[model samples]
Target: MIIMWKNDITKEIEKKRLKIRKDEDLFETVEEVFDTRTLMALYRIINKGIISEMRGVVKSGKESRVYWAKDKNDNDIAVKIYLTSSMEFRKSIFQYIQGDPRFKVVKDYRKMIYTWAQKEYKNLQIAYEVNVSVPKPIYVYENILVMEFIGENGVPAPLLKDLSVINIELFNQIIDAIKKLYNKAKIIHADLSEYNIMVRNNKIYIIDFGQAVTIEHPMSYEFLLRDIKNIVRFFRKNGIDVPDDEVIIKWIKEV
Candidate 1:
């Protein structure tokens, strides 16, 4: 009876090991892309029960890559990882963090990247709290930020720039979203454009808040005007009779 019990236990252990191996195999390609430090950071996050599995890349950009992942409860999560080796990114993000009262100046590049990730998370949180249409922020660890994925399965919603159908109401909704971000969230999406606006389920969502600045920033109004201009330009090109950026800006500034 003891010998039979030992054989059954060994078989169960082997089955569990096989299951782990199969799960790890799914991310083999993803594992090859991360560096040692990033891998360790991801390991720490996973061990903390934040992430159950990382699937594949959902969006790829010059400075970062967003991956489709799942939490312990199998809920969809977007994991955005800032590339530490991108020297251009390191230099470009300096302007966004320079005058922000929230963070101190950091000389280390890796620390700066971490700070950038944290900044985006905080920006999303602020926007979300104010009913702005943005991905709900979950957590930020090192250079990785986890947020609510804004699409179904592993597929992300199409950018406003990619949508074939454009309507006047949608344009108006985008304008209202920007105004709300400014008045309620008190932040300017300095880099706002059609490229970062996601269209899913007939709703517009603003994204890529890494460069958003507080209203106190010296360039806040300038950034706000630029955001308005970008949205107006896009809508005009799509044949929407949009008002001028100045008019929109003046209306948004009304208290």
Candidate 2:
């Protein structure tokens, strides 16, 4: 896990933008590409032995920014650093995070994100332990998470929604895998849509577990059903045969 760094990319980035204020949360205060604290965290990771350099920014979502980084062994890594400077961003994830047992005591937004980041790291570890196809987690600190890069070279794998290959067999495998994730792992990939599952080298790698909650948690059944709905819907759109309820039933009863 990357902890800290000596370089200051934030200052360099600041130099590029002359009109912006130099506040600590400058990244969040403005409509800039990234938050100041988050960029510093990336620099810290690089200055330390955790990562060599920041390759480039990949996706900047509402809560976090994902970047490609190189590790000491010259292997590519994906770093998801959350922005704690924005309460608005924090508000977005609260609904999915509020009921989790781990974050029952979290009160502040930053603290909530810290807990969420930790939860994702733990979820990834659990999936790996259960032999679930997922990115191997490397390190997590503050609201930052580092993991093995999912795509080959410097490019990221496209979401399953954009690509289709083979037949219902592989699609069935995805269904079976989701069932195993529920039955064996006792967790739901809450955001289990075509956008979250990646198909690479004809194998499926499930990404983004930040919203995954236990089956016993409140609204778990709803989330699981939605996942089944999305899985079935996407595959069906690709010309596969099977009803959503049939896939749901198979997942619940026999997978």
Candidate 3:
């Protein structure tokens, strides 16, 4: 004979969690509609102490959901959890990972997103190596990526596009930072735009490196030029008269 205590009935309580399903704001609505398996994956991560507490769901992107979590030391960490769905990612991922040596083995859509997250982890590693102020990647398991939370207390830094840094000082620093990124990293952040860069303490911190690509890749120059174009466009939008081609050339030959 065996008896189960109140705490022993935790699984039964968690069974009610089946009601959880796809977040409408997320890129994909749940395919299975309240899949116990996906929930189990989330449970496994939580149980492993990777994140001691997960707060409110933050912004949802085209492929992942951003969550604010607290670690063992009570420090905040940003968790980018990729949705299990893949229809959207299948279309655009090829451009970023086409020449990635680590991704040659990945063939399926689901595998591709996981590979994308892995790529992001590697990109962060490269950036940090060169002293770029992106988030410090902690752990990336499957679709989940845990990184240093870019915030203090409860406020995250506002993105560059959201704030104004008036003066040549801020602009020049941004240009210099891009120079380091291009020269040292030998990679271009393909999707970089004003919205993905953060301005904190009058310095720039680039984020969202998922689309960063190698310099030798066929699309590398295309991506590099596009990045320079976007940066120039942003600054020009803010009333700065600058030449996109000149900025690209300056970074290439003058840096």
Q: Where in model 1 is the C-alpha error above 4 Å?
A: 1-5, 8-16, 19-23, 26-29
Residue 64 of model 2 has an lDDT of 77
Clashing pairs in 1: none
Error of 2 at 59 (Å): 1.9
RMSD of each: 2.5, 7.5, 4.9
Worst 10-residue lDDT window for candidate 1 reads 22-31
| Residue pairs that clash (backbone atoms under 3 angstroms), model 3 | none
Q: For residues 1-255, could you state the per-residue lDDT of candidate 1 as single tens digits?
A: 355588889998999998789557644835566677887788788889998888889977789989999999999999998888887898799998997888887999999999999999999999999998999999899999989999999899999999999998888888787888889988888998999999998899899998899999988878888888888899999998988878888888876
- Top TM-score prediction, candidate number: 1
Looking at model 1, residue 61 earns an lDDT score of: 78
What tens digits encode model 3's per-residue C-alpha lDDT throughout 1-255?
Answer: 777788867866666553243222221422233245455665567678887666755667667777777888899888887776756877778867877655674677767777888889888888888887788888887777888888665467788888855555656666666666678876778887887887777767788888888777788777777777887788888887766666555656454
The per-residue C-alpha lDDT of model 3 at residue 54 equals 65
Best by lDDT: 1
Model 2 stretches with alpha carbons more than 4 Å out = 1-33, 85-88, 164-166, 253-255
How high is the lDDT of residue 235 in model 3?
83
Candidate 2 matches the true fold with a TM-score of 0.80
